[model samples]
Target: MPRLMAFDYGTKRIGIAVTDPLQIIATGLETVHPKDVIDYVKKYLLAEPVERFVVGEPKQMDGTESQSAQHVRGFVTLLKKNFPAIPVDMADERFTSKMASAAMLAGGLKKSDRKNKALVDTVSAVIILQTYMETRKF
Candidate 1:
């Protein structure tokens, strides 16, 4: 069975997450540099079967597109071009970072550990994936 992948895109770093083959649980995967994301995805795809890409879509509180939206759109275009067979979708990413931070704190992470942006990114991706999954009937 194939899995669904999610990405929390940033200017400098990208957070990644993927569901199990059963598509029931989402797990934090990795964080890659912006320039290395495509290569990272390619390498990951070689090992795992990914059926779809769910990218975090940044939006303002007013429901307007955020500045980072353009970058995500560009990345989506690149993903479509590079992996035409796989479908790409966007999940609203409002407040995921904040939610991730709270999760880390609730999980008893230390200040130093919570300060790791990469970890936060990964958790954010997982949150995005989980949120997206909730909307699907399956």
Candidate 2:
């Protein structure tokens, strides 16, 4: 089976995560500049067969679309246009950042390391991928 990839899109950086071939485990891949997303995905596709892309959809507490949603939407459009074979989906990302921070704390990361926004973004991508995997039929 092909793998699934997740992206945590941010203004400055994007965190990436990927599932195993069996789609059982979601692991953090890397944090790359937002501008490099297309190139990164293309390179990844050359290296591994991925079937789907899960992007974190940021929403307000009341479930309204957040400003960042527009940016993600554009990214989704780009994905569809550039890689029509790979489907793109969205998952609610309400508190994934907070959860990532807590995870870092629990993992014994230093305060300085925990402050790294890129690290939190990467962990958030992993959380997003895991959430998608749990809710998926397969």
Candidate-wise lDDT, in order? 0.96, 0.95
lDDT per residue as tens, model 2, 27-79: 99999998898999999999899999999999999999999999999888988
Candidate 1 per-residue lDDT over residues 1-138, each given as its tens digit: 899999999998999999999999999999999899999999999999999999999999999999989999999999999999999989999999999999999999999999999999999999999999999665
* lDDT value, residue 100 of candidate 1: 97
TM-score (C-alpha, index-matched) for candidate 1: 0.97
Give Cα distance to truth, residue 34, candidate 1, Å.
1.1
What pairs collide in candidate 1? Answer: none
lDDT of 2: 0.95
Candidate 1 overall lDDT versus native: 0.96
Which pairs, if any, clash in model 2?
A: none
After superposition, candidate 1 runs with Cα above 4 Å error: none
